[model samples]
Target: MSSRLLKICLIFIAFLFFSCSSSDDSTPSEPDRSYEDVKTDFQAIDFQTGVNDVSIRDINGVLRFFRVIIPEGDLSSNLRPLVMTLHGASGGNPDAHKNTGCFAEEGFAAINPIIISPNGGNLDWIEFANQVLVLSLFDLAINYLPVDDTKVVVNGYSNGGNGAWFYGETQPTVVTASIPMASSYNTFNTAGEARRIDVPMYVIHGENDELFPLQRTQNWVEATRSAGTEITLEVAPGLTHNEPCNYVDHVKNAAIWLENDVWD
Candidate 1:
């Protein structure tokens, strides 16, 4: 062969090898669990009504914490909806699980969905790193558990409420709706996230919240509503920042709104 033809053959071989390698490369599904290990954990789930502690290592090698609430029933039911409950500013998922029992219980009034609370720790919802970790965890749950990806409800309080708004804005197509309580619009994109909510959003704020003042939330809510997004703000009569349990009834209302109005 001539030198030119020989060079052509080498170039084609290199191109083919690179194409195949790029096509085959993929990120690991989870940090620790193998495919068989995932199967084992899925099978080992108690499937009873209780809270279980779970952790997943993100691509950054950080251990993300989560508390999952399993419902009382057989696991053979059709794919179930998932309620992601985000805690406030600190203590991560444990703070949410212990103090917000009223929320997990009454928030799902009629629809018994799998409840998961992720620990925010040092990262806030607005950060790209946190979004990656959270979305990875979410993908893991949907893959291993019987989760219906279509009907996802993200509810949050304080900083997590800000996260609720962030996800609703970022994952509008996947998230069915959001119920944010006592969340400040001044957080997570500086509440710029509130302006981009395409999915239905129902906000619950105390009339007398000292943290992240109610008026700021109201201001953003009004602005967002002017843009024609479907949003409802429910102002609790006399609730305060510290009393999360008091918002159970409000969350119950948001649940009814989801079942009767939104979750078609």
Candidate 2:
């Protein structure tokens, strides 16, 4: 073959390989489990009325979540709202349920996205890669489970609180409301990139919080509101960073905000 023709063919082959790789990245990859497998395994659990710790995968082959479904046994139901609840820096999926029992009892399905434990990934919530993993988990849940897409909510506590802020700001289209408890990000000027999230948000932080303090939540509320978003901040006085009552009220207020609150 002529030298010119050989170079052209090589270029074409490279282009084809690059295009295929790009396409693969955008598409949602299927999990190792089949639909029947998911059903069979799900049925084995007590879906009648408690949290189900389930796992789903992303396109890049990471096992990333536990779905907390509040089941209403034997009843033929359609799509239901979902709350994606994330845990703090101290623990993983186990503590997520133990901490947010109110959401499970209220019959709202939640997916507790498993943060990469043991720390290679950043503890900070704003990383785009982490956001992508969480979003992929949501996509997986929508397909594998009976969930209403429009009614999806995102929430977290402590480190997870920061994660909630990160996800809400980064992927606004998938998240309807954001509720963060105990911990919050830096000021809007520093973390204001997420201020574009105009979704209804409820932020609760303890006034005496030693770990994350009230100032972070205050800054988040102020920044979001300044950016023309609807955000509510509740400071629980005399409550420490780990107070149970603060969490109780956080859940209560979150549910209300998700239902009646409107965004600009």
Candidate 3:
């Protein structure tokens, strides 16, 4: 070969060697096995501080907003109870916070999980995305909210009351007590498949509720209680669906229940 040809062939060989060596060195590594190898490591007592207006990405990668009510004073290893109150499908986050008094009251240390309310849309809490949003809020509270992880309470009114039942039945582990008011009866299509729920429930319904007849709400309470679940059914006489008893009786009942009950 000519000298020029010999030089070109040497350069081509060097390029080939470099490419092969680089490929070998940069082979894709085995993926991080930490997430897969270990089950979800949840230290429920890690953070003692409280955060509000927490915008967390849910299971569907949607950004949902939540307000957390943390216990007063230093959150020592001593676990304090956590109560989560969800507002009905008709109300906004601010309304939920206001109605439940979770932010106004300094006592409960509760979290109000808010799902947005649109003027015209499917008006049911069964929407899969909505449920996932609620679950994500629970996860955020469980992982971040400083409280007694074991004493989680779920409560709501109207659309929110139904949501309380749904969450109690679906995520039984996180729900130690349930408070539902002015709610109609509803069971998910996967009701039987739901994790067994023995969580104590408190039902608040108006005797004169014309919107959702009292019978239905009463039946819901009786059915759940007959299933051997601890429950307290309070019937407010001469009250409408949107009864003031939510603030007076329901909140009082919730306080009493939490003070006495212990969850497994």
Better of 2 and 3 by lDDT: 2
lDDT of 1 by residue, 168-234 (tens): 8667655778888899864224645535468899999999999878899998888777777788999
Report the lDDT of model 2 for residue 53. Answer: 52
The parts of candidate 2 lying over 4 Å away from their true place are: 1-49, 56-65, 73-77, 91-99, 102-129, 187-194, 244-246, 262-264
Give lDDT per model, in order.
0.69, 0.54, 0.52
By TM-score: ranked, best first: 1, 2, 3
Top candidate by TM-score? 1
Per-residue accuracy of model 2 over 1-264 as CA lDDT, tens digit each: 334224333333222111111112344454444434433443454433454554443334544434455546432356666677666764333334354554323322222222111111333445544554455445544544556666667777678777777767655666777777776675355533645465677777888999876776686678667778777887877888775444565566566656666421
Q: Model 3: how far is 252 from its true place, Å?
A: 1.1
**Which one is best on lDDT?**
1
Clashes of 1: 0
Return the lDDT, model 3, position 224: 60
- Using lDDT as the yardstick, the better of models 1 and 2 is 1
Clashes of each: 0, 0, 3
Give the poorly placed runs of model 1, Cα more than 4 Å off: 1-49, 91-98, 186-194
Ranking by lDDT: 1, 2, 3
Please report, as a residue range, the 10-residue window in candidate 3 with the lowest summed lDDT.
15-24
